[model samples]
Target: MARTLAEKVWDQHLVRKGEGQEPDLLYIDLHLVHEVTSPQAFDGLRLAGRPVRRPDLTLATEDHNVPTLDVLAPIADPVSRTQVETLRKNCAEFGVRLYPMNHAEQGIVHVVGPQLGLTQPGTTVVCGDSHTSTHGAFGAMAFGIGTSEVEHVLATQTLPLKRFKTMAINVTSKDGRLRPGVTSKDVVLAIIAQIGTGGGQGYVLEYRGNVIENLSMEARMTICNMSIEAGARAGMIAPDETTFAYLKGRDHAPQGAQWDEAVEAWRELRTDDEAVFDAEVDVDGDALTPFVTWGTNPGQGLPLGENVPDPEAIVDENERVAAENALAYMGLEAGQPLRSVKVDTVFVGSCTNGRIEDLRATAEVLNGRKVADGVRMLVVPGSMRVRFQAEEEGLDKVFTDAGAEWRSAGCSMCLGMNPDQLAPGERSASTSNRNFEGRQGKGGRTHLVSPLVAAATAVRGTLSSPEDLV
Candidate 1:
């Protein structure tokens, strides 16, 4: 049978089937936990008198509430501190390993998973965070779960789930390859623009075609991480040479002859040419351009050089009203060029763009330039590996010397889970995925951009492309 990539991997990991009585039992290969979502799950484990069925499969970290500036003291926000404390207590009680705040291994759960080689191809990964799709870069079937589901996995090391429909999103670049200036961010934003916010309902999107195959692993991750934002249950890229190369010698990747066997199995994890999809979408990679979000949702985005859409021109009254309100809250003028808009802060980290390539792209702009006087610039690595690499290559020095604050690895400002956040009324140009209201903090306006755009904006103190700095 011609099976989809998702199905190919899922079948390999299924421990039980969906009979008349229960959902399919999916054996999870990795369970990433963070402070905000793990306490209750651990407590549930204690109450149920169960130990983590496979502690080796679970990894915990303290983020979202960790202070990026000063890790030595108690967190100032009492609620956040309590959350972190609870996680520490829970990990201790369960005998599950944890990367505490400021520890070298501590960072965004999604980021640490990939960098440490925990995100293996053909694996099933789950987290309490929605962006777990980021691990799809390695050809894993990864998704986020709610608190109840989190507890269920903590107790059973498996999930009861109904299968998702398969979809193929083919990206074709008429020019034979992706354009020079456009990025994976542009590709995803272009997709959202065409399909709207709810396009991929009930489907697990599989990226295919020449353009998609050519994207770097990090780029592929950027595309996958926003699948949920497109209303897809998850997104995946078929395991390939690029995927194998990226996982070859990582800390957690399978080694020796076992690696060869793993690779052989992963090679079969592709959608057969004759496989059918419930839905399909095509994009011309050449048509893509650097993109920036203009409103509250990630879908409310436009090409960087494009103007903010005039809400009045929107035919749907409801969408128009929402746009109008978003415009007001964002302090943006409708119809104004998004690139010309002023920026108050520049953030270059998160699960989305906190890897080495992201830092290099940002550092390329920060080489000799300084962050604009009033604009606060933050550079947080996504993991200790990324941090060590950046520091070894002096990327940290470049950021600090460029006048941006270099923070420890964590999910800083990605969702305001930690002390790194935008204060009320402060607007920021961020590299994270979402731009929802209060996503960073109350009244904390956010504009999503590429790492290059983020770095350029930091120097210019305005939303802009790296070409402007060049």
Candidate 2:
């Protein structure tokens, strides 16, 4: 039978086929653990007296609650300390490998997996994280699971899930790529803007065409990481020479002759020419520009040069209501220029855009430039290893020279879990996913942007793009 890339990967991992409404039991190739969600799952295993079924396939890291500054000192927050300690004790008891804070491998679970090359083509990956779709950049069928599902996977190394319908997102351009200053982050924001947040519900999105294929692995990861915001089961890009090049010589990737064999198999993971998708969406790469959200949801976005949307002008009743509510919550005036909105903070780091490449881009923008006096800029790497690499390349100096704080890695400012959060009523231009109400902290406002935009916003003290700096 003809199959899509997602379908082929799904079939390869099926332990048992489903009939009627029965869910198909699929084998999990990699299970990632973190401090926030694994506690209850580990406790469940303890109560049931069950050991982890595949310790070798499981990896844990400290990220959510770890301090990005003063890493050597004891955790000042008692609640965070307990969570980190609990993960240590549980991993020891369950025989799962853990990379604790200050360790080189320690960072966001999604970032660590790909950097180590454990994420591969035609594999099934799961984690207790919504951004697990980040692994789909390698052509893996990855998705986030709840605490109970976490327990199920830990004890059995398998999960029973209903199959997902496939959707193709074809991105084409007159020049075969995005223009300078526009990036993968803009591409994804444009997608969510075109398709409302629930547009991809129950579907697995496969990104294709010249625009997608030309992106670096890190850029592709950024694209997939935000799939959850679009309400998709997951997002993926078929593995190609770019994928193999990124994996080569990584710590966990296959070596030598095994590498050749793996590549050969990975080449067959593409969709068949005659395979059909459940739906299709087309995006013009040439028409896209640097995009930013003006409202609470990812879909409430416009081009950098556009003005805030007028809710009264919207014809759809529900959309108008949402726009009105979003404007109220965001403190934005309808029809005002987006560039004129002042920002109090600028954050550049997260699973969505905190790779070495992202840091390099930010540094390039900030080179010989100074941050606006009233704006505070924070540059937290995605992982300890990423921090090391940036420092080795002197990117850290560039950040500090520009008055941005260069902190240690671990999901900082991406959520309310860590100390790096926005104060009440604070507004920021951030290079992170999800700008929902209080996503960064209670009563805080966020504008989702790319690293280049973040750097420029830091310099201008407003929502901006690199062109504004020029």
Candidate 3:
């Protein structure tokens, strides 16, 4: 039978089939944990007197609440400190491997998994964080689970899941490649804008065609990372040369003869030519310009040249109501030019765009420019290893020389779990994923953009692109 890429991976990991209406039992190859969500789960296991079924497959990290500025100092917030300490105790007692704060491999769970080569093709990956969809960039069947589900996986290394309907999102560039200044981030925002936040509900979206195939692995990861924002259960790309090349020699990746065997198996993980999807959408990648969110949700986005949308212009009553609320919270008026919007902050880090390639792109734009007066820019790497690589390549120097503050790795400012956040009513051009109200801080307005756009906005003190600064 012809099968989609998702179906192929799902079948490979299926441990048992469900009888009519019951969910199938899928074996999880990796279960990633973080400080915020695992505490209750660990307690559940203790209460039930169940030992972790597979400690080697479960990995934990201290993120979400770790301070980006002081790695070794006692965390100033008592609640955050307790959470981190609890995770340490749980991991020690359970024999699960943890990349704790200040450890060389410490970082966001999603980022660390991929960096350590633990995420691989044709595998099942899960985490308590919604952004766990990021692992699908490797052609894995990856998604987020709830705390109860986390405990279930801890005890059994398996999950009961209903199969998701498949959606094919085909992206093609008119000129055969994306235009300069247009990035994978822009493409994803464009997709979300085309299909509202609920469009991908109950579906696994497979990104394919010329444009997606051509993106670098890191860029592909940026696309999949935000799949949850569009309400997709997960997003995936087929494993190919780019995927193989990225995993080639990473620490946990298969090696020597095993590597060759793994590649042979992964090469067949694509959709068959006759495969049919439950739904399909095509995006014109070459027509895309730099995009930014104008309202609260990611779906409330427009191209840089456009003006803020008027709620009255929306035909759908539900959508119009949402637009009105978003504009009020964002302190934006209908018909205002998006490019004219000024920003007090610019953040360039998150699992969505905190890789070394993202920093390199930002640094290239800030090479000889200065940040605009009064605009505070923070550049946080996604992981210590990513930070070390950026410094080795002198990218950190470029950011600091341009007046942006260089910070360590963590989920800083992305969800405002730590010190890096905006004050009330402060607006920012951020490279992070979500722009929901209070996502960065209480009453803070966030405009999601690419790293190139984030760097340019810092220099121009407004939502902008490298082309605008030039």
Model 2 scores a TM of: 0.99
**Model 2 off-target regions past 4 Å?**
none
On the 0 to 100 scale, the lDDT of residue 3 in model 2 is 99
| lDDT, residue 410, candidate 3 | 97
Which pairs of residues clash in candidate 2, taking residues 3 or more apart in a chain or in different chains? Answer: none
**TM-score for all predictions?**
0.97, 0.99, 0.99
The digit string of per-residue lDDT tens for model 1 on 260-356 reads 9999988988888888898898887777778899999888998888899999899999899999999999989987998788888899998888888
lDDT of 2 by residue, 1-470 (tens): 89999999999999999899999999999999999999999999999999999999999999999999999998899999999999999999999999999998999999999999999998999999999999999999999999999999999999999999999999989778898899999999999999889998999999998999999999999999989889998999999999999999999999989999999999999989999999999999999999999999998889989999999999999999999999998999999999999999999999999999999999999999999999999999999899999999999999999999999999999999989999988999999998999999998999999999999999999888999887
lDDT, candidate 2, residue 30? 100
> Candidate 1, which segments miss by more than 4 Å at Cα?
none
Error of 2 at 149 (Å): 0.7
Candidate 1 similarity to native, TM-score:
0.97
How many times do residue backbones clash in model 3?
Answer: 0
- The ten-residue window of minimal lDDT in model 3 covers 173-182
| lDDT of model 2 at position 445 | 95
